[model samples]
Target chain A: MLHAPASPQADLQSEPNDFSAILAEQTDRLLAQHVTPACLKAADGGVFPAAAWEAVSDAWLPLALVPEAAGGVGLDAPAAAQILRRSGYHALPAPLAETMLGLALWSAAGGAAVEGPVSLATGLLRLASGTILAEGTMAHVPWAGAAGHVLAIAEAPDGARHLALLPRAAYTIVPRRNLANEPRETLHIGTAPLGPDALLPLPAPLAGPDGLMLFGAFARAQQMAGAMERCLDLAVAYANERKQFGKPIGRFQAVQQMLAVAAGESAAAGAAAQVAAAAWNTDQFPLAVAIAKARCGEAAGKVAEICHQVHGAMGFTQEHVLHFITRRLWAWRDECGNDAHWQERIGRMVCAQGGAALWPRLVALRAAANGDRGTQP
Target chain B: MPDMRFATVAFPKDAEDLRLQVRRFLEAEKADGRFVPHRSSWNTFDPDFSRRAAKAGYVGLTLPEAYGGHARSSLARFVATEEMLAAGAPCGAHWIADRQSAPQILRHGTQVARDHIIPRICAGECYFGIGMSEPDSGSDLAAVRSKAVRGAGGWVLNGQKIWTTNAHRVHYLLALVRTGDAGADRHGGLTQFIIDMAAPGISVRPIHDLSGNHEFNEVFFTDHFVADDFVVGEVGDGWSMVTQELAFERSGPDRFMSDYRLLTELVDRIGPAPDARQAVETGRLVAHMGALMAMSGSVAALLDRDIVPNVEAALVKDVGTAFERDIPEVARRLVAVEASLDAQDDRFAEALADVALRAPSFTLRGGTREILRGVIARGLGLR
Candidate 1:
């Protein structure tokens, strides 16, 4: 079934002033300054980039997505997406996106604001009477070791969904890392006892199946877009600086062509991620995010290949800074349901609608997005 | 970073409001058996269909009311054009005139040319063919050998233009010819002229495509006389005019939605329940299309702002055409049917065959992928 446009009241419920230019500028400047190569390398070695994390914390970046009524800056999903892209651009070791989304989820669930970092986990839980029992293992829990709390969404046997805010100490953490050397640990929960207040009802959007995954995929798409932007930057700079046959390699059509393709891929990823962000909280969310995750993930691989190919052997070495962004791109491409996963999901949904319905469906999706505010130029 | 950004563009409410009307018109056309959607592409030339579409107020959109146009937003035109392409409407007769030439003429052509040509285009009684490419000038447009010399009342043109689509049928050809010395830049000598195809000293030879279609043509001009009133913009300023026109040409729904019909057929043919591979591949194509539409739509928004998105346009064509080419490749892989035009009983197979044969031109026309990428590389400051 096509995701119909949300009602006027439901649309008004969202923070209309979601994207603020001032916040976007401030976030961009902050990421550019503090999330430097040195901090990234330090975080790669498993040492928390305390200064960078503190800077973002001081800026209230983690709480940016929390609703203003909940005593936090009500940055909507579009603005949050821009910040996430910046986080990916700098390859910031901290789980800023994860934390921001986690806090937002927690706040929406009527949970009190907690300090420090928060990581996100998804699994199943057993709810009997008033007791909440979490016993499953959540793999690829981003920054679980560094976070002070874990925001989890687990489905119950009775088809009820609950959001649990559990302290990090409650669950056993097995440290792990992604291709970018950033923490993406696994959490093993053995009958973790959640306080009665720890379990709260979810917001409407997240009350459905794969709600967190939808947002997670959208976040990863934004990050991939940011990483692709950086990779293109590095490749273009290197192409103009690196000389081959007594001329800058950029002068060659082959190198220019490759970098050109990289630019297109980066633009496509940006467009997809931005549209997905704009579709947040609307009926178009699942379809838009699916397109974003699939398109951005596919663009990520092609862009990384071209960016690296343009940089030659230097980009492959650890000494070069391109890998900081490229590796994160690779890791993010696999996260939040990889390209094939989302592609199949989109394909199944679209095919079921039949070929005749595809045009109207796509137009309706665009129409719903157009009816929103964030999509304005 | 690269300064190459596809800004978020949403269809304006006015444009969205027009979507239902366009769909209704298309459906009515389909119900009346105006054209077979499965057998038609955007390149399908039918003057009767074009006339009806014009009467429905889709042609000459975004042009001035003074010139018999509706004076709608580019986004409105974007929505209308995409609707036409999606329905596989035979839009070739008015496609060029409504898309690029009419606008170019309105913007730069003489008062006489605009007054005479624009209204006819709006009425779907006039058509245009691009006369930029020549036998020796494919990608090297600046290397055009066509030249026009001062004549009795205008300039006498003499040269050859190849790959001119609809040359034999189009009433006019917007020919780019050299009129002066080729300065150091090589772009200095060019000029654009609105040539009357009915004039003497011009001949068109059909170049049959691989599918036995005669859409492509090679035209020879021997002293084809173009009056002074037909000149578009100032002499020696054709390069900028043509480049500006390209952003309009390369960035529209036409770039990516050429093979959209085949995609729809593929989805329907695969049925409601596709195997994992088929679903995954089809989904990938849809995702790519979604992104391309956004990118292309963003370019439309940029054009509406009068900010020439040259590089952005190039990126759209490059990526969009790639997606267009990928449709047939993906379609054949998921289904076990021999693609043939003779498979009249199987719409999917026939659509697949038609697109497979025409796919190569999607990238080659407007601008080749390599050329577009080169343009993008330049935008990235790599040139």
Candidate 2:
């Protein structure tokens, strides 16, 4: 069902003047129309929704992060991130974020715009001479079997980095699934043969391990923020509708307090995601991304717990849509480096800079982000 | 999904310039032995420091130049406030008037009231205390029984207000008094009056807090006379006005930065090299602070647009005060020391002692946690 690529004529880019609002509205509408409870339930049976994929493709969401000069919509990082966030809010059962980042990275590495979904795995392939070879097994590659191509960042023997675009035939895949029942495949790329044109030198910022991790972490952070909002919404609606002791559960102060805390967490996660997304292309990427991922990841757990507690037994059932979002939140928080990992990185960075330098560092970071006028609010 | 609106806003470039000026002024004050850092916070009442700050044009930042203010944007004021809190400036003298009372007067007060009070407030010579909380009504502000009858001059007030911060020192009190029936909504018939502290039949008794500080007081009134011009807005409109004023009072750098001195002291005590535990814990606090700063800044932008983001403000107070309450608990766990207020040589210990004693009131002041959460839930449509 996921074999065919979307047609080039399916481009549905909004006008450049007010693209963010339009794109957000369109994405929300698309998700509301296609991602219903029945469709989500059917998707739990491991059936890929071809119609949903086509609708998203028709909206050109997968190409949101790509530059306009690269035959893509060329929305700013925050705009693109809003697309991912809305997708997460809908619990989109596809590799939308991965594909968006994949196409951006591929085009940045001098590759042509690829049509189908593209999965990404870091530090799995090595470049020798003119051919790209797989170094080890790449685990937890989202939609590896479903993607038309897999992009991996490989380092050569001389320590130079390169991005290799491997076709589906180049590697063997073992299908896996995340906690949300979404495909998370493993790629066994042992001595895969790639043409010379497939391997391109990785750019400076994108070449490092921190860069890839930060990128993936920010993506998940946005997703977690979106999913958290959905959870809070579900819990609140349930509280207002569900009856207990002859009154709506929401009438109880205890439930209201829990929902309030969840709202706070959701707001914090959303704000953190915005900060990270706004600083996506700035020199403050590492610090911003680290804080975003860590904060969002932490919020994800607390929000999920509060939501579940407010929901009671009804929320724990697979029949309810709440678990669909909470499960994805659980999966997303652990992927691409969890909160502890990013927190440790931040801890090391701040401690290394010492106590007094911390404020100055944050001020400098804010200055750097503000200096990039293109994305300034 | 829930529509959560927290649009991230960049502090204006000119705000950065203002930040530099604030930093320079603070540094010079410290150098001249005017005020000691870590010895004061927003809650510390120091009229001398407030006078200095007003002289430097840091007070009443959002008010217009005609009202003795600098006519700066809210973001500029936000920058100045963060600087004050981070430096542990004793801004309590002008905090209430500059933060909410003056804005309330400018927005809803009578023209006579505004003309009589706002300029003095901006000059840092006048201070105000909130009188919404009566002896019987703490978080249930609607339960206020401070009756005011239409008498000779304006209103004859007779009631008592407890936990009135700076009531003993301030020049005026913004009191919410019951003037008529509560109607069916329990919000009507209430009115706010700007009562002079030195008015006849008005008395203030000091209430020492846990830290041995007489910062709060129990204010009593027996037939206290309030001038007709001192009434704020229309009578029976106090509930909505006070609720709107809370959006300004609840969400600012002040809510979260109350205990910032402790965090700074913790970082300074940890020094350049910290263990994994200290770094992880401190880093988490820093990340939380950064997020809160962004949220608070967004609210500031909303205030600048003349939008009352009551729900967003409630969320900030709920989250920000919780963050403040956690700072001292986290700091004490990270270091081994006997927290003492008299530790002159150990600023960290002193700060820890001060914060530990004060953290319980963080969520209680402005509004209690329970009240804020209820407001948020209603905003979320859960109620």
Candidate 3:
């Protein structure tokens, strides 16, 4: 199965000013105004929620993959990741990750625009016969329970990349518990996957040595960032409310120090993730992605432990959401190419080249991703 | 701190071709075996050779032309340092002075100090050392007990300084002294002086590190006399001055390029197209260095713009040291080369063994990792 290279990005343009900040801010507004209020009302309309997706889709959140010409907001990678992370933070039990992942595949296929109640899954998918063959069941699929359109990626037997798009009704929603109590489910699609035309003949499924690791890392790092944020909020709330020695626990030095470290973990992780996502948005993929993954992976546990300690006995209790946050941190820490894995990868890349060879390597990666392999710098 | 700022980073858009020019110069130096490739390129002393280097307009490349300096951008100076370091040039005599002292003098020192010292430094003659940390203070810089009280003649100093690298050999010391008693807050009232090392009240004694290298020294000043004009910056501002110098100290190729020689050797020994594991190991390290270099280069550009990105600089130094220390470990793991403290092989092995033994100090020397994290934590609005 020879995968065709993705097209040279022709629609690479500057997004509107404050697009990311606006979208991030909208996560709260939409989550509170639309997502939460909407989801709590429609839990009986099947396990997968089309109502929520349709609402978000109408709001231009679903067409994140669409270019400016296609009547979409034309959000880039970083902006999308930011929205997804906030989605995680708000625990808006919706299939946003799925929609974005599918739209990503659709965008790669030169589709008109991405839309509908969508969801995304990360693992391996393959195309087989007339059916879009799917393999590699995705673990920790966010919003899997509420997705209307699920995009599952698999490598075909012929080596061509395939994207399987199943409607909300098609998936067997085997409910699963995620670290955070966000909606998750096991997606089992038959060999007769989705429609062939729906299985867009996309280029390589971004499963290369570094790209896959990076994308995976970015997603996990985003989730970890959300957990870190939640932890900080949890700790701050606990510190303010829990009193000891006739004062709030936050007044104590030891509590403050631990809280400080957790805050640091969040900042470093967020900084690294943002930088990486920003790089990806600008098409500087591998190096930025690797750095983000490494830093975020290291920060995940650090924030979790500090935060858990800050919560003390309450955190360990299921009644509180602290365990939920730490659990996500634990899961997401190893979700991408773990810290050790990416560190070794980065280390080896650095050692192999001359101190000054980074320029050529970057130029080469861009060219390759742009399907201009023979273009020498 | 969270402003939308842009750092141009240190890429001379059209000046990459100039690398060839520098490489040619280094090659010429290497041809006749004029370059020895010492273990400590910048720290290794070679006064005559350094004078030759300055004569080539390589030293003081960033200072103002009015002061006999080359008036080049920091990138150009960076180019010169990168080349010198890559070639293992013994730039000890003028390295610190060129990198730190001249800049301080040009920016903050008295006109007399700049006139007397700048041209000579540009010509690779006079040198200076940081006299910040005391014997008890260490990285707890605010704890500096080296006090200088105002006297009629100028000032009288009685204090002991430690870890003053190349201080014994340098012409002057930029010692931070308490000009007045500071209560509660340990950093108050400290002043920086361009202390002439040859003054009668000063005694410099070399203290070899655990590596048996006469790298640093302890200097005791008993009633050391200095003119009021000798102060580097305003009175009671030594802490800020030292903090600013740190942005200079921490953000440089020096942070990561310390053991780069060993890294290169490891790769050279690895040969072309390494096995899967080796490729993975070496590839990742090299990639990280690339990103680290880019980040550090960004900070350099930030410094060039006169916007002291202290937090960004701290990030660079912290991440840079972690990568540096990991280099030797990765290299050793890749190829189980015979490495030990007692080795006396080619200078390659000697340097590797030396760097391996000394790598622990990489994090410790430039503020410990713990402190760096604390700094970063604070910078991130976490503390």
Q: Which has the greatest DockQ?
A: 1
lDDT of each: 0.85, 0.83, 0.65
Q: Which stretches of candidate 2 lie over 4 Å from their true place?
A: A1-21, A128-130, A207-209, A363-377
lDDT of 1 at B279: 93
Error of 1 at A49 (Å): 1.0
Predicted candidate 3 versus true structure: per-residue lDDT over A51-110, tens digit per residue: 555566666665554544545555555566676677656544555555555565566555
Judged by DockQ relative to the true structure, which candidate is superior, 2 or 3? 2
- Score every model by TM-score: 0.95, 0.94, 0.79
Ranking 1 against 3 by TM-score, winner:
1
Candidate 3 residue B249 Cα shift, in angstroms, is 2.2
Please give, for residues B126-171, the per-residue lDDT of candidate 2 as tens digits. Answer: 9999999988999999999999999887989999999999998999
Query: Clash number for every model?
Result: 0, 0, 32
Candidate 2: pairs in clash:
none
Candidate 2 chain B worst ten-residue window by lDDT: B1-10
Interface C-alpha root-mean-square deviation, candidates in order: 1.7, 2.0, 6.1
Model 1: per-residue Cα lDDT over B198-311, one tens digit each: 989999999999989999899999988999999999999999999999999999989999989999999999999999999999999999988888898888987887989999
The candidates, ranked best first by TM-score, are 1, 2, 3
The alpha-carbon deviation from the true structure for residue B298 of candidate 3, after best TM-score superposition, in angstroms, is 5.2
